[model samples]
Each structure stands twice: as C-alpha cells, then as structure tokens.
Target chain A: MGETSARATHVQHGSHIDTIESVDAVFREQRKLSFAYGAVFFVVTLAIPAMSVWWKSWYAVPIWGGFTANYLFVSLLYYLFLWGLSWTYIKKADALDERLSHMADEIAAATLAAAEGGES
Target chain B: MGNLNIIAIVMVIGLTVFTVGLAIFVRRFTRTTADFYLAGRKVGTIANASAISGDYLSAASFLGVAAAVYASGLDGVWYAAGFAGGFIVVVLFIASALRRFGEYTVADFAFGRFGSSRIRLFTVVMVLLTSLFYMAPQMYGAGTTWTVLVGAGMFGLSPYQTGVVIVGLIIMFYVMVGGMKGTTLNQIFQFWWLWTAMFLVVVFAFTAGKFNYAKGLEEVTAENHRDVKTVTVAELTADDAALLASVETAMSEKGFAEVQAVVDAGDPDATVGVLIPAKNKLHTLRDMFFNEPGHRYNAFDQFSMVLALVLGTAGLPHILNRYYTNPSGSAARRSTFWVLVFIGTFYILAPIAGLAGKLIIDDAWRAGLAPANAAYVDGLLLKSDAIMPTLAQILGGEWLMGAVAAGAFAAMFSTTGGLLIASASAIGHDVYEKYINPDAPEARKVLVGKISVLFFAVVALGIGLGIPAVGLDKAYPALIAMMVTWAFAVGAGAFVPMLLTGIWWKKTTERGALAGMLVGGLGSFFFIIMNILKQLGHLPSEGVLAFVGSLTFPTLFTFPAALLTIIIVSKIDGQLPKNVDEIWMRIHGTASERHEKELGLDKVSTMFGNSKH
Candidate 1:
C-alpha cells in the first residue's frame, strides 16, 4: 500500500515532497499532455473506419496492385503511426516527469520554510 | 495438418517439457504475494515488454489473425492492426498512472482507488468474468490445434477433448508451481519463439512459396471473395434457393459434383461442403471482394470493434496486472513502447501470412500437394483457422510446420498462464487475503492462490469443451479472433470507463464507478450473450431483442454510455472517498519515483537473485 494514500495531504520521499497543490499542478499538466495526444490517437484511429465505411475510394480503389487505401493503411502504415505517436509521447512524458519532479520539490520546500518562519 | 507429423508433435512435446521444467525451477522463488503475483517488481523494461507482448498476443494473433484475413479480407486485417494499436491507449492514458498507483491486480487498483470493499468485490467479479472470456478462445485454440497436430484421442477422450484437458491441466500445474515469476520468464521465451515462428513462415512464403505481396494480393482479388460452408441439402434447396446457384458459380465442377452427388442421394439431411459468394455487410449493395471491406463486419461494427480492441486493452485485468511488475511509472511507459514495437512487427507479418495463404494454398491444393490433414472445398480451406500450420507445411514442409505448431501452443500457454495468474490473484489476493483472512500466513495464501488457479483452469477446460457442443465454432468465421474481441468489449466497457474516470476525473464517486461498471460490463455481457444466441438460432431475428443482439461489438455504445453514466451518477451523488487528495498525489505524484531514483531503486534488478521475497 502507498503510505501517501493512507490519508496524508503530502507524500515525502526523503527531502522531495508531493504536496497536494504541487501534485495538482503536475496532474493538470499531465492531463493536458495525455488528452492532447489522446485526441490525435482517437481521431486517426476512428477515421480509418469512418473513411472505410463512407468513402468509396478509401475502401474500393486500389492504389498499388490489390492494396486499396484502407487495406494498405490498416495492414501496414497504421503501425508506423502508432510507433511514432507512442515514441514521441513517451519522450515528452519522461521529460515532463523529470521537470515536474524538481518543481514539486521547490514548492514543497517553500511551503515548509514559510511554516517554519511563521512559527519563529 | 491432422496427419501424424512426427516432428511437429515432438517439437510441441519438447516445448512443453521445457516450459514445465522452467516452472519447477522457479518454484523456489515463489515466497510473498508480490513474488507470486507481480514478480517482486524486479522486471526490466525490455523483458517486461516481452512478457507483456506474449501475454497480449494469444492464439488470436497467431492463428486467428491470418485466418481472419484469409476469410474476411480488409476487415479481417483490422484484427491485427487493432490489436497492435491498442497499446497506444495503454501508454498514453493508463500505463504510468496504473503502475504508480499500483497494487498487484486490477481489482487491487480498483479497491485502492475507490477505497471500498464493495467496489473491490465487484471489481473481482468483473476481473474473473473478463479472464474467462479471454481464456475461452485460448481453450478453443488448444482443442483446434490439438486436433490438427495429433489427429487422435487418449484414454477414450476425443482428440479435441484430450487437447483441452491436457492443456488445461498442464497450464494449471505450471502456474501453480511457478507463480508470476515463472510465468514472466516463460512469457518472454514463448513470445520470441512465436515471433520467430511467424517470421519463418512469412520468410518461407516469400522465398519457397514464391509469393509477391502486392501481386499475390492482386491475384487473390481478381476473383470475388467467397465463403465455404458445410450445409444440409434441405437448407441448400430451401425456399429462394439461396445457396444452390452460388455453389455452382463459386465451386469447381468436381467440388460441385461432390455437392451434387450428396443432393442426388435424396437425403434431406445429408450435408455437403461447398463455396458460395460472400455478401457485403458494410456497403450492402457492393460485391464483396478480397481486398474490400465488409465480409464479416458492417459499418457499426467496423468502428465498435476497433474501439473494443484499442480501449479494451487498457481495461484487461491480466494486462493491467503486468504494469505492477514494472519498477516505476516511467519504466511502465517505456515497457509499453517496446511492447508496441514488438507486437507491431508481429502484426505486420500475420496478414502477410494470411495473404500468402490466399495466394499459395489454392495452387498447392490443385497440385494435390497440400497437407492431407486439412479439409478443403474447391481448393479453399474448409476451416480457415487451419491456415498457420497448413500454410507452414506447404512452404517449408514438416520442419516449419513443427515450429508453427509449437508456436501455437506457446501462444495458448503464455496467455492462459497470465489469465490464470490474474484470476487467481483476483480471488486469492483481492478476496481471500483482503476480506476472508487478512492475517493468514504467506504459505497459506500461496496455497489458496494455487487452488484458485486450479478452479479457473477447470472452468476454462469446460468452456473449451462446450464451444463445439454449442456450435460456437460454426457461429463465426475466425472464431478465435471474434471471441477475443468479445472479451475486449467486456473489458473496455467495464474497466476503461471506471479507470479513465477514476484516474483522470477526481469527482468520480464510488457509486458512479460501480454504476458505470454495471452498465458497461453487464450491458456488454447481455449484448454478447444475445449476439451468440442469435447466431446459434436460439433468439429471434425480428424484434427488439434481435436488434440489440445484432450488434457484433458493443464497445462503441457501451463505452460512451458507461462513461456518461459515471459522470451523471457522480454529479448526482456528489460524494468522494475521504482520502481523495492522497489518492490524487499517489496517482500523479513523482516523489516516490524521485525518492527511488535517489536510492537507485528505480534501476531494475534481476528477478533470479537469491533473495527470495
């Protein structure tokens, strides 16, 4: 079980702290990044079938031998699209996590310092 | 091929022996519940990715994808792409958060996130149901592959029954003995074996079978797509004569003569195998072609199925459980990326094997050189599901066929092993340890987990046996792929909505998650049962029940409906778990990760280390 999840407003790992407000900021950023990529993924994925169903050329007309646009895209190219999307998403996400880790520590330190100064 | 291929049987036996031996060897490492269920969280990125790929790619990808492509054309190819594309959802939306907020199983995540015993129990039921749905097809594949390989029964059991019982028992024994660590190692090895087998078959297709991709596809598409079936004379000659003329047009004279001779026998119930032109379900007016859409799916299904496959992946209990094996959230994300690359390559090769079969098998059959074990109608395979082994035999003969046969069993073993682990954890960890007896010793808990595996394996064996009796094997073309998609639909409906909302939407209440799961999960169950019953002729085709049953995949409707229900119900309820802030930090926070990084705990270690538990 996560110790933080036991009802603390903050999770401290050594000196690094995840205050509720810090995590909320991180959450908003992550949500934005994830949803932005998610929008593209769903659009491209759903569009394959949408076009296959509605557009004649997409499903019917063969561009290379018997490889219709739908057949070619679904069978071959869509994977490249996935590989590209996931690869870039992971790189960006890892970078975001790294950047936010520092920001979260700063925010937590500032909170702790303010409390100490006020008490003195 | 059903004929006694000594080499293929020997290969399969050899693989089985190796798998069992590996399980026994890993049995010593099985100590804590974490070790038993999550491999002690020591798994590396690439290795975990390999295991995840093996767990994800079942007999559905190995046999069903090619068979589906051979049978349904463009729509069939979606099975491959949809499957590989699913990891996108995992990496983007689910993987990192699940790993960070992780426990052992999906049920654990549910309970922890929602903070309730009620939700946990409900999640456990959904987990078990989802596992069984996925396991059913693997069981079916076992029987089908066994019939293809051995061609005989043992101890008075039919060949299919022999396969089902033996496979079920072997997997049960191994999973019980080794636990998750053993399963993870085996999954990595099995994944490579199957990937190599698929690659070899495709390579053989190009080199030995002399197949050219675009040209071969063009050749196959030169003729209209057709379906092969075994039909009784009465049905064939029934009002409107739906099948009589088309049989003649689609079949060769000799093939049609076989049907004609059966008709001339004057037995109304006499069955004959024949080929008939396929109908376009999508367009309705266009002729079905080998390269065109809608041999199996209509427009609604085309979208629904893709949704099910992609979204449903994030919801699968077994796959979700794999995320916990990762050391950190970033590692989980990296593992998913590797998984996509591994499976994407395999998916690309599968349809080529299908296309190769379409181009090569008919010629081999005409030459009277096709493997003798497979049934054929007008040079078309009687059961397209036999394409993997059958095609392997034609291209590279016994050696290649043996490799593919072993690969098929590996697929079943890897997947069923994972599902058994997931199902066992759902009961043993989520139910027994948490609710029944929290103070039980580790050994007792391990025993209970093993017992749970035994129970579910028996259930899976029964499902394998029942498939043939209920005519489910005949109810759909490429039955393995279709059935797996049904499992995906259930997962997508049940878990994706809840997980997506629970992780992403903070306002999501327990009542909302439960309501969403009930509607999405049970709704999918209802629709699937109705669809199966309708296909098996146990339901009417003219009423409201029939209309609901006609939906081939319910994810398109069920997913959104479930999501909306969650929002509305949560809005009305307006209550949240008291520890919501802590839960939020756990889900989105990086302090644990930063702490781990400082202690160098983020670095993955070897699971084979001598420190048991």
Candidate 2:
C-alpha cells in the first residue's frame, strides 16, 4: 500500500502522499472515464446479438458476396472496433494517469493541511 | 493402428519436449515464492501481454472455436468476439485497481479489500472451482487432440484415456518444475507458435485450398445446413421412420446407402451414424443455413452465450492472475491493450479456419482425399473437433497437419500450465502459507505449491476421463466449446459480480461480496449440472426443473442476480471495513505510482533484481 504510518489516514510513498480527499477526486474522474467507456463497450457488444435475434436483414441478408452483416461484423469487423476502442482507451487512460498524478500531489497537500487545521 | 500419422505425432512430441525443456531451463531462476508465482513481478508489457493471450487462448480458442463455427455458423463466431470483449471488462474495471492494489492473487484481493478470513476462504473455493471448471475443457482438448494425432493407447488405456493421462502428467511435471517464470516464458513461445499455426492454416486455405471467405459462405449457404448423429436402429424406427426418412433428404446417396445397410440387416440394437436435416433453433419456421444465425443456439442463448463468454473471461482466476505479473498499473492496462490486439487478430483468424474447413474438407471427402483417420458422414466430420487437423491435412498436407497438432498441444499446455499456477497459489499460498503454516520457509512453500499442482492435475485428469464415461461427450454436439462455456458460466456467476461490486462500489461489505459469489458461482454450477443431466436424459422435459436445466449458459440470469444480491446484501449489512479509506487509497491512489515513477519502477526496462516491487 506504500503506507508509512500505523494510522490508515494517509499513504506515504517517499515525498508523495495520498489523502482520502485527493484519491476521491481521482476516483471520481476515473469512474467517469472508465464507466463511460464501459457503457459504450457493453452497448456495442450486446447490440450485435440483439440484432441477430430481432433484425432479420442484419442477420440474414447478405451485404457482401456470401457475408451477412452479422457474419462480417462478428467474424472480422468487430475485431477492428475492439482494436480501435482499446487503443484509444489505453491512450486516454495513460494520459489521464499522467495528468492526474500531478493533480494528486497538489490535492494531497491541500487536503492534508485542511484536515490538520480542522483538528487544531 | 498401422496407419498412424508419423509426421503429426513427431511434431507433437517435438512440442512436448521443447515445452518441458523450457520449463526445466527456467527452474533455476524460480527459487523464491515470488519467482515461482509472479515471475518476481518484473515482466515487461509486451511479454506479459503475449503470455496473457496464451493463457487466455486455450484449446477452446485454437480448436473448439473453429470447430464451433464449422458446426454452428454465426453462433460460433460469438465465441471469438466474446473472448476478446472479456479483456474490455478487465481494462475498464479490474486491471488498474488490481495492479494498484498489488496483491499476489484474486483471493488476496478479496481478503485485502474485504478484511476477513471467511471471504478469503470463500474466494479461494471459488478460485479452485473456476480453475477446475477451466481445466476440465483443456483436459478434454488434450484427449481429443491425442485421438486425432496418435490414434492409439498405451498400457491398455483407450486412446482418449491415454491422451488425457499423458498430457495431464506432462503439464503437471513441467509446471511443478518450471513455476511461473517457466510458465511465462513457455506461454510466450507457445502463443506465437499457435498464432503462427492458425495464421498458416488460414493462409493455406486462401492460397492452396482456393478458399474465398465471401464466395465460400455463399457456396456453403446455397443449401440448408445438415447435422450428423449416431442413433440406434430401435430409436430410428420407433418414430415410424419419420426421422430416418428425414435423414435421406440431407444425406448423400453414398451416405444414405450405408445407413440403409444397417437398417436392412434388421438388427434392432445396431447403431448407425446418419446425416439429418438441422433444425433452426432461433427461427424454427425457416431452414438453418451455413452463413446465418441460429445454427446452434436459440434467440435466448444468443444473448446468454455472449454474456457467458464476455463476462466469464474476467472471472477466470488464471487470466486475472497474469495481470499481477505486470510491472505497474499503467503497464497492466498497456499489457491488456496489446493483449486485445494480439488475441483479437488471432480470434479473427480462428473462424476463417472453421469456415475453410467446410469448403476444403468437404471437397477432399468427395475426392477421397480426406484424412483416413477422421470419420465422416455424408462428407461432414462426425466429430467437428477434428476439423483443424483434418482441414490442415487436406490443405497443406502432412507438415501443416503436424503444425496444427503441435499447436493444439501448445494451447492445452500453456493454458493448463497457467491454471495449475492459479490453483497452486489458491491452495499453497492462500490456504497453506496464510492459514496452515504462516511462517513456512520459502523452499517448503514452493514444495507445497508443486504438490498442489500435482494433486489438481490428477483431479483434472480424472474429470477428462470421466466425461465420456458419464455420457457428457454425447450430450453436446461440440463438447469442447460447450464444456468450456460451462466453466465460463460458473466463473461469470461466481467472480465477476463480486469483483465488480467490491472494486467499484465502496459500500460493498464482506457479507455482501460472499453472498454474491455464492449466489452467482453455485447458482451457475447448479444450472450447468442440471443442464448436463437434462441433456443426458436424467431429467424430465417439461417442468420447473427442466426449465432451469435448459439454460445452456446461465450467465444471462446469474450475472444480474449476483450483482443485485451484492447491492441488496451490502445495503442490509452496511459494515464497511475500518480502514476503508486506506484500502481505497491503495486501490485508486496515484502517489505510489508517482513515487515509483521517480524511482524508475514504472520503466519497461526494469530487471528482476533491481526492482523493489
């Protein structure tokens, strides 16, 4: 946990610290980003099967030579979407981690000072 | 017996030797428990991603998937898509937090996050169950592959039994000796070999076999799909020959003539294999087609199977165990991203092999050029699991068939090796070190871990042998893929809900998570066993019991019910851990990674001894 003290109030890793307030901030931002991507993923994934059952044209009609939209999507195109979704998600997630790492330092210092002032 | 394919056998033997040799080579570096379990946590992003893909792509992906597509059409394609989508759940929800938590195993995560021995033991049980669930299919693949490659048994064991026992023992010995470091290295090497093998099959299909994806689909779908089955003479005649007459329409004159010979002999007890018109499960009013939906599953199963496949991936302890081997939270995400890319491409290729099998194998069968070792009814393989090797034999001759045979073993070896590690840690690390002997020496712990591997390998071997004995092999059209989905269903029920709630929902109490796991895990197991019984004719066809038993994949129900149970139970219990904030910080905090960043622990170049992790 990178914890230095017995009390579980804050985690200290060398010169850096993580107060509950700071982590809560980072968590909210992360939850937003992750859940947003998660929503898209679940929607897109479940949509294919939903289409298979309900949309006859999607499942039955051959758009390509022998390939129905369902076959083409499931066999080949779905993977393209997966690669695209995951690649963009990773880049965004990495960027979020970099930007938030700096913000966490600042937030930790401010939250710690405020907590100390309140205690005094 | 005299006509055994020497080339395929030699290739498989060569692969086993190389795998075992690699494990032995890494044995020296696997001294510490950390090294044995996590490769000392210094694995690079790309290497770790490849290992995860190897661990994730079992015989189910290498063989079962293509076989499924060949038999079930678009429904089979869902397996590849679902397997790949599973990592999305990992990346979006579990990967970073789990890595940030930096625990040894999933059981550790449960204990660490929830703070109780009860939940920890509960998680351990779930882990073992899921691993065993996963192991059963790999063992089945081993047996099936052996039947295809070797075609004979040693020590009076049947070909299937011989395959199960030998492959199980080989994996057990290697995993015990090599540990995680060995498993990791071997997984990377094995993954590339299988990936290349599948790639070669598809490439050969296009070039030598003159297979075109669009044209092939159109050609195969020109007629309604047909199914092959073995039925006793009594059963064939019991329905006033309605079923037998139906079979004549689907079978070729040559194939129907063979069926006629057995019936003409007037042997009531005689069993004959025949081809029959397939029923469209989804669209019962229409005929089943090769390139369309409803070849295998109905409308409900279309959704349930997808959920089972996608959600079940996250629940697999073996796959989740690989994430802990990554160097950092971001590295874990990167590893997962690359994992998606690698396996994504591999999955895309698997279905092509399945589709290719339809065209190439059928042509070969008509020309009398199909492999002699494989049994066929009306040009369709009696056993779809034989499609990969059989198709390869027709397309690229003996060498390609040899490569495919080796690939099948590699898939089983890499996956089973990973499962053994997960199972060992659940028992050796989670149970033994923590509860049985908290202060056990590192060497002793490692020994216990190896013992655990040996025990589970034996159990898995028994399950594989018992599958055919208990009539499970006859209960499903595609046994390997179906059985693997049972594991996925169980894992999806047992783990995904608990992990999702435990990680994302702060109010989640120990009682809630445990209850959720029990509901999801055992609920899935019950439905699966019931379904198996129904398929085996042990259950009546039209009752509540039958209704529940008919759910091929229970994840559609179990996942939601389990999630709701967690929410409801946690709300009622309302007992968060005392150090919830500290735990939350450990899970979501950035100070440590920042600190590690300054110290260069986040680098892809970090070596084993230099790292503090």
Candidate 3:
C-alpha cells in the first residue's frame, strides 16, 4: 500500500517541470546558434549600405562594366549570406521545436503552481 | 460597364469561386483567435513561404515593376532590385524576433513590451495611417484595370467606382467569413495561376520573335541613335517648291561647307551633317540618356533608394504580423528563409519577362506591322510598365488579356486583405480592448474588429474611386510608392527603434518609449507633408532637393533624435515601475510553439481573460 501511494504521488508531482528541465541543454545550444545567426544577419544588413558607399568610391578601378568589382562582390556576398541563413534555419528549427515543447510544459507547470498557491 | 470583356468577367467569377471554395474548406479549421490570425500556426515552411511571397509581391511587384521597366529604360530595374532585396532583409533581421515577441498583433507586442495603454493607442493610429495609404492604391489600381479592360459607366457610376465596389465587396465577404486561413489559401492559388500565366505570356512573346530578336534589336538600336546620324534641316517654306529650292541650296552650299569645316577640325565626337528632310532633325540616344528632362540618378539618391528598401522591410506591419502566424520562433525564422528562396526565384523571372516584352515589341515595329513604333524612338524601351499588358494582348488576344487582368486584380486584392486585417486588429483589438471596453466579451470584441475591417475597406474603396475622379489614374504607382515610403519612413523612424529598445534594453521606460514613438512618428509625418507639397506643386522641384533631400537619412536621423528624446524624458521622469524585466521576459521569451497552439481565438481570448460566457 505504501509503495502504491508513493507511485501515485510521483505521478502527481511536477511532471512538466521535469520535462522542461530535461531539454534545458538543447535550448541552451539553440540559443547559442540563434545568436550566432543573428550576428551574421546584422553584418549583412549593414553591408548593403556599406556597398552603397563603396559604389561611389573615386579610387576603385571599374570592373567588367562601369561598376566596380565591389558591387558584384557585395551582391554575391549577400546571396551567400542568405543561402547560409536558410541552411542554418532549417537545421536549427528541428531542435527548436523540442525546446518549445519543453517550454510549454514549464508554462503549464508554473500556471498550475500559481493557481494552487492562490487557492491556499 | 457594358464594355465588360466576357473573358475578364469569366476570370473574376473563377477567382471568386476559388476564393469562396477555399473559405468553405478552411472554415472548419478556425475555432479560435489563433486559427483566425495565424492558421493555427501549423503552416509548413513551403506553403507559408509561398503565401508570404504572394503577400509580398503586391500590385507593385506584379504589374508596377515590369510596367515601369517597359516604360522607362535600364533605370527602372532599380525598383525590382530594391523590392527583391527587401525579402532578404526581412529573412535575416526581423521575422524571427517578431514571431518570438508578439502573441496576437504588433499592438500586442507594443502593449506587452511597455505595459502602457498609451503606447498601444499610439501604435493603432500609426497602423491605421499606414494601412489606409497602402490599401488606397491597390483599390485605385483595380479601378484602372476595370476602366481600361471592362469599359466605364455603370449605373451612372464610372468604371473606376464600380470596380471599387465590386472588388471591395467580394474581398470583404471572404475575409469576414474565413479570416487569415481564407487569405492564405486564395493567395497561394492565385500566386500559382499568376505565375503560370506570366510564364506562358513571356515564352510566347519571346518565341514569336525568335529570329527577329537579334535583327530587330540591332535595327532598333540604330534607329534609337538615328538622331546622331549626319543630317541637315533646310528650314522649309510653306510652299513645296520653295521648300525644295531651299533644301537644294542648303545641301549644296552651307551643309557641305559646314561638313568640310567639321572634317578639317577632326572632332571625332562631332557629326558632319548632310542635307536632310525639312521636318526631320538629328538626335542621339546619348542625348536622351544625359540631356532628357527629368531626375537623373545621383549617388546619394541611389543609395537612399536602396536604403529605403532595406530598412523599409523592417517596418512594414503586414510583413511583421506574418511571423506571429508560425508555430515557433524558429519556424517563423525558417519560413523567412524559405521566403528568400521563393521571392528570389520569382523576382529573377520578372526581368526575363520584361526583356521578352522588350524584344517582341521591337520585332513587330521593325516588321512594320505595328502602328505605335513611330511614336517611341526605335531601340528605346517603351514604358516598362506596358510590357506585361502589351505582351498579354500579343500572345493570348482577348483571352490572355482577361487572364492578365484577373492576375492584377488578385495581386491587389490579396495585398489589400492583409493590410486591412492588420489595421482592423490594431484598432479593434488593441485600442478598444485597452481603453474603450476593457471588460468586453470576446465575441463583442471580435465583432468590433470585424466592423473596423468593414469600415476601413469602405474608406479605402471610396478614396480609390475618388482618385480617378480627380484624374490621378495615370500617376497611381509613383504616388503609391511615394506614400509607401512615408509609411516606411515613419515605421522605421518611430516603431522600430521603440520596439527594439523595449525588447533588448533593460533601461527603456514608459516615458522614453512615448517620447520616442512620438518623435519618430511625427518626424516622418512632417517629411511626408513636404513630399505632398512637392507632389501638389506647392513646393518647387528645387525646393524639394533642398529641403526633402536632406532628410533622406530616415532612420539615422530619427533614431538618434528618438533615442535622445527617450533618454532625456525618462531621466527627468525618474525610475520606472517595478517588474519591468519580468514583463519584458514574458514577452520576449515566449516560444513560437506555445503561441502557435494557442493561436486559436478561444485560447488567445482566455489568455487575456476574455469572458466568452
């Protein structure tokens, strides 16, 4: 009887808390990857204006057409940046879903605890 | 409108049936706010990517860019480049963050970030202003199509007015019943059909001119530079004999003298002229490029043009709101990445289509089969905007013309639907919920939102119809682009800085947020006033260069000013209320998945304590 009661109590314990904590490691990794991606994005967004300045620079030699090589180089860089971001987003999203499911559990647990405390 | 082309009528009926069918199909899926707004946030990357592309392409991209290119020359490609690059900026900087932060709308983000009722009210106003401007042009463009294709004068109303009512009513019906789900499904299908039609039209145009493409282009180029060829004008008299005598004398004497003198001088660039017809005069393509009367490209203006595209993407509320529809922040991010691919691919085809139109028209003119060839200089692209419509007529006759017409209508309708929804939600949900009826039932609140949508849709339709009555039909795109820039400038200047700071910075306060939003909003508003002045002839062209040109540093100028305003005001107001970090974390840290599932209206309402019972 005592063993049965202990199992019931365990089942009724903070299952959500346990689930969320279990995937904390994955969330940590995802966060790190997201930040890295963010940094790259910030750099590329800045590059467009940077190239605008580069386009009018007096000292650069014109390549192919009248446009300097910098214009084409920047365009190619942006394209690659986009390609890289797309690749990373797909790979990282799989792990992110696991993290989010855990987060939902945590939110549920916290809400339950707060309700219990309010009633008490 | 008795001039209603049967093909156009058929296409419109087809579109309505398709949209209604989708609405009926998706109705079962929508049970709550989440369903209404985000499609239950379960939209897979590919479908969502296509929908996003459909939404982003707008009338501006579908018809305007190609037309602008066809009408103008190489310079019109700037529009295409700026627009396509906007998607890249969206994918990288803003989409994921927005999805992660906001639950229902952008106003939800504004409210959550600052916990200020004032900020929510301020944001709603901005939303209304931006959405109205964005929507007006789409409605106006629809009117133009109706007039040109279907003929005018229905029930004592012009074609423009009839078009306004017809499109507005149809769209409102579908949107009211189906919401975002309806919009997405219709947009995706329309996108597919539009793409197919565009592809066929382009292929047929190019194939028709296969052999002639090369020869025609060379001849057109030669003809374009015909003004440079050596020729002389003899100043014709009224009588034929007098004109002939004058031409002969001029050719034998002064013309040869001037030609010999030029040869002796050995000026490589200068032309030595011989006698020509009395009416015809020499002109060069180089002269048209450099000396043609209009705004020439300058480095800063060019830079600002690009900068507007990049920064403008960050500020568009309709685009920002799409992120919230995804199931997770990562999914939202992934969707944006997919959008980059979809948009990039679609945009690449547009230039090819533009080129095809260019070649086909040139061929027809060279074959002496076209009557209008004499109107435009040979080798010069006619209005780039006319390429699609002209190509449609060339390849498909009345049937293809009808299809192109339908595509244009779809493009305008879908974009208008998205913009209207965003505006209504901002006003009804944010403004009314916080201040007007804080304790209102969920059903009542939704009713108000619907009413707002109806109201705005009507207002937009009215303005669209009215614009044509005022004779602004021909200038719609340029006017729309200009106003859109104002919306972008304001959003970039005001909302972006405030929201970014609120999310990322710990020191942001209610006072600072208020001040920043005001300054950014007002500064852009003032800039728009100057733009309007220029458009209306109150301000001279020179006045614009002096005053408005200096403020092209939209974000850079407004950012520092808003930052300073916020910091100073906040300091004077003293410390902010407690629990700021917790609230900030609550908003910023919510995963997209949790929000996605709760995207249902019931769940969202309950989250905010909506008393459904």
Best by lDDT: 1
* lDDT scores of the candidates, listed in order: 0.91, 0.89, 0.58
Docking category of candidate 2:
high
Clash total of candidate 1: 0
Tens-digit lDDT track of model 3 for B451-561: 877888888888877775654433322343444555666766677667656655557788888888889777777766664544444665565454684443355566568
Instruction: Mark the regions of model 2 whose C-alpha exceeds 4 Å error after superposition.
Output: A1-6, B605-613
Worst 10 residues of 3 chain B by lDDT: B288-297
For residues B1-613, could you state the per-residue lDDT of candidate 2 as single tens digits?
A: 6248888888889999999999888887787888899988889999999999889889999999998898888888888889998899899999989998987899999999999998899889988998888898889888887887778889999888998999999999999999998899899999999999999999999999999999999998999988878888887788789888998899888888889899989999999888888889888898999878887788888899999998998999998989888879999999999999999999999999999899889999999998877888888998898899889888888899899999999999999999999999999999999999999988999999999999999999999998889877766777888888888898899899988888888999999999999999999999998999899989999999888878888889999999999999999999999999988998998888888888886776532352233
Candidate 1's C-alpha lDDT? 0.91
Q: After superposition, how far is residue B584 of candidate 3 from its true place, in Å?
A: 3.4
Candidate closer to the true structure by DockQ (higher is better), 2 or 3:
2
Decreasing DockQ order of the candidates:
2, 1, 3
> What TM-score does each of the candidates earn?
0.98, 0.98, 0.73
Question: What residue pairs are clashing in model 2?
Answer: none
lDDT of 1 by residue, B1-613 (tens): 2478899999999999999999999988878888899898999999999999999989999999999999898889999999988899999889999999967888877888888889899999999999999999999998888877777788988888998999999999999999999999999999999999999999999999899999898999998899988889998888766778778998888888989888889899988888999999999999999899899889999899999999989888999999999999999999999999999999999999999998789999999998887788988888888899999989988889899999999999999999999999999999999989999999999999999999999999999999999999887878999999999999999999999999999999999999999999999999999999999888887999888888999999999999999999999999999889888888988888988888898998789775454
- Residue-wise C-alpha lDDT for candidate 2, range A1-120, written one tens digit per residue: 343542477888878898888898899889999999999999999999899888999989999888999999999998888888888988999899888888899998988898899999
Chain A superposition TM-score per model: 0.89, 0.91, 0.48
Real interface contacts reproduced by model 3, as a fraction = 0.07
> For model 1, how does the per-residue alpha-carbon lDDT over A1-120 read when each residue is reduced to its tens digit?
123332375777765788888898899999999999999999999999999899999999999988999999999999999999999999999999988988889887787677679999
